[model samples]
Target: MARPDEHIHIEWRGGTCRVKWWTGEYLPNGRKRYESKGGFLDEETAMDYGRDQLYEIRHGIHVSNRKGATLMTEWLDDWLAGMDHGHLTERGYRSAVENHIRPYFARKSVADIDVLAYRAFRKHVNGVLGTGSASNVMMVLGMVLDDAVPRLIKTSPVERTKRRGKFTKKKKKERKKDMAPAVVDRLARNAEIFFGFPGYVFMWTMAMTGMRPAELYGLTREYCYPNWPGTDPRPDPDEEERYAEDLERYGLGDDRMPAIRVERQVQYSGGELQFFPPKYESHRTLVVPTFLAEMLDKLLASHTSRWVFPAIQGGSLGAVNFDYRYWRPIADGVAERSGPRVRRPRPAIPAVPTYRGKRLYLLRHGHKAWLDEDGHSKFAVESRMGHEVPGVEGIYSSVTVPMERAIMKSLQARWEKLQQDLRETDS
Candidate 1:
């Protein structure tokens, strides 16, 4: 070892000179670690190489010797296990890593992945997977590499070039615009035929309350209107005084203002369903029109189970069961399936004319559109949609009793108008 200002050690090899420089780090055995470059034609050239390595070491951007041997698969395992993300998210990351990412970069070391290597992986995923899946896979890869910066590699190579910006939008799938409320009603009518009365209730509640599908499935009799003994969304001890004050100003009672508490959703983790908070932890109460409130009260009376929107088979509805058994038959006509038939399909149930091949998630989007169309307060609309208002608006504005009443009135009027339209058609 020598002083930091002195030239690095150089030695004569078989036909050329070799250089080795102290890395200012030590091994567990208390021996100094050295970074080396060999087979240089002369000592000056070798000394230059040694200087660059020392500079990198000094700047805290030095790549370790083992980096060249650190395979992509090895890094993937270490990175995924370091954090405990939600089960669904972990599952998605693993799917992309194993099925798409690992296969291509498995043998390659982390140090070898550069911008060109990233572009190749991006092209491969786009060619093999759908546009959405490709985007997700790329995102996962970029995240992992970005995490490796300055430790396993100097910097992430996943750069979005101008060429990428030009073609990516063209390659990406166009998002479907929000569905019409009338279309949602048509879908509900079809669902009623397939999944009994609860089926009808599920569609309307989703469209009206803007609850996510999982939230609706996890909805319980206690959270829904007219059955909850008391109205206490914020139940902490410290909030009691504020709540009583609200009661004075807003008549905070279950009977006074019918609402649903967006508490939790069912998440499939490990092997069974577990209760998890709503996405973004958007725990808020949603006011429902009086008509819908009465309808829920009637349904909850005969329903013995805890779930508000139980499956047709009499259990809490899961995404898998809902999509194939209940939703597809209603969204896409039962008789019009494309895949090879296995068992005898159920008797033909006609699809909703306007919602053919559309997703149930669209109903939530349409709910937002309806709120905007009605010209409700931004704070109230975002609160109802389970979305946090951004910037100062979220900080200063709050959903008041008047806002909730206005929303309820607007929704009720929409429902009444639709009923009138149906009656006119029948006449």
Candidate 2:
């Protein structure tokens, strides 16, 4: 028999009794709430727990009484729906969920998540997606668990320092290789000749400015000051202020050099392209080499689109299309060595050294290396790269005009030397 006010039941499984009780509560949408306690020696202990659970639930405290029956998939759905994350971040998280997390642990109880289970999951992910993607999947899972702490889950099983897979900080840093100056020249020249104007400007700007791909893709005519101090509209008041005192000392004006104002980046989110601020809100202006400035001025004179580097087919350039269709072929070595190598219909190019598996981002790193070689201040270098310098140096030190001028001078010399080499090669 059961009390009429509260619905309670007892059952036996494998010579053990368990108790289940329906709390006299309903969801806003008219669904009943139920809880259970199990694996007890006898009905007496089970009923005691059942009564305790019912009391807790009735009084509006339900976390303690949760039976860990909530499926990971269900909780993740709720969590993801409520999260206010960036478009790319949300897309990646959803991908991790759909591709790896859901298939392995969606049906499992969150309470059952432990170190051993996470290790097993890591092995599975590594086996299928390899270390890089597996690393991203693990990070997403860790984020979900972190959010679930003391609510849906007891603790996060994924340790940031663990060596389960090859997914570690050191390994990630080790994977990024820098490009040589000659290599960058080759890439830019190949891009200009093979892919035309958009590719030409795109490669040159990325190599010289060290701007992120999203930032480069989002470059608009309005933000580019190809003639800078010599010829431009009203100067940016904030940028002027940042290096004003230094400029006064160096007898320089705001428009002394060509520059690009990096404010927002393009993101493909929610099945549409949207413009937003740079990652970590790193907004700054980058001074360009004189040669690049002249080239960009020429480029701007020809085109009328708001975007400086529009796609080849007349829309926004996507990262995937740019890498596979444009960069990959150039990096894998183009026809540069002889008469009419009819590989892909292009003619009269020489065979160059192939750099297989080299990434486009290495060009940006090469720019950083150049700045480093030129002995620029750490703060200035980091600022130019659109990265926030950590600790006290970032807060105190400022980018001086002399520092900017020095970097500009070095980059200009490099570009001039490259042009001379290209001219000599043509002759």
Candidate 3:
């Protein structure tokens, strides 16, 4: 038996390997002693393990007859690795750990993490990062720690931590300028001039349909038609001829009509474009207005690829890179020519405002605003936007092409009016 503060050595195989168990001074107060265990194949290993066990015993982490020891980094790695192959998407899970979780707590011992430290981390993140971003980071941390609790590690420090108050009640004020008609005109014109007709049409489609940028990029030729040959009655002669002309002009071979499908989205991640699932509530379709149908036919005639919009990089256009260096300057020039200056104003403190440089998502917002202003039913708007309708609307109602076509027509009218206003003001 080993008394507190005394180390007992054990000899194995005629002292070829030595092991030690001890009782050590208690931690925080440094007064009492507690039992600890350590054994090793080598003198160095024994010394290291003994020293660590003694520390744990002193700190009250190693309890009587229980082996409680694992490095925080080691546990984290195992936990993350296990999750990577599980249901979680590898990219998102890795990002959560790499960008948020591991960076803060990787080096600290699991026992050293306390509620106070966690609360402080949350506060720092909220102050330095925006509340929304901080919330997401906290969510990731919470999830990982929750999984860790009662499994690889003891109770997580995050479980006891509460997010700071100010962030809870904050609702971001919508920047009214984003959905302003003038901004759309400028963006639409620039998209047309620099990216070509398909780009222009694509921009408008996003505006009218409220489809996510990824959804717009994901549109295939098959998705343009509401019905396939032999499914619904063929378009009237004039409409058929118009479709034929549009298809031929764009050089899209033979097939003219197919059901519009939204099965995939193009995402630019890791410096390249990759197709992925559409954003939450983004996998949807809307009927094209006659004019838009005509425009789409014309645009498709000019494109050679199967994609509705393809990159010109001499390969299949998988993702539309939003970070293309040329996009901003071209957009700025068009903004200058068409309407009020759209440059993000610098804050007095020179810090980037939360709303600054988020013009890319504005097209979608403008679309929603247009729908809301035109008295489209909330369900219809939610369907087109791919957002889950609330309550009974989601439970019972279904959206059809006629409803969507009507929405498109309304959007087209609004867009034309804005364009007309722009031309008049310029002249």
TM-score of each: 0.88, 0.76, 0.64
lDDT of 2 by residue, 133-234 (tens): 888998888888788766765456767776545644544454555555566666766776665676777888898899988888887777776533322233
**Residue 307 deviation, candidate 3, in Å?**
2.4
List residue ranges in candidate 1 displaced over 4 A.
5-7, 162-178, 229-255, 335-348
Q: For each candidate in the order shown, give its overall lDDT on alpha carbons.
A: 0.80, 0.74, 0.59
RMSD of each: 3.9, 5.9, 12.1
Error at 72, model 1, angstroms: 1.8
When summed lDDT is taken over every stretch of 10 residues in candidate 3, the lowest stretch is 346-355
Per lDDT, what order, best first?
1, 2, 3
Please give, for residues 376-427, the per-residue lDDT of candidate 3 as tens digits. Answer: 7789887767788778778998765456656767766876787689789899
Cα-based RMSD of candidate 3: 12.1
Writing each residue's lDDT as its tens digit, candidate 1 over 178-289 gives: 6665777878778777767788888888888999988898888777776552554655788688657545443444447777878888878878887888887888778888
* Candidate 3 residue pairs in backbone clash: 223-260, 223-261, 250-301, 250-302, 251-301, 281-386
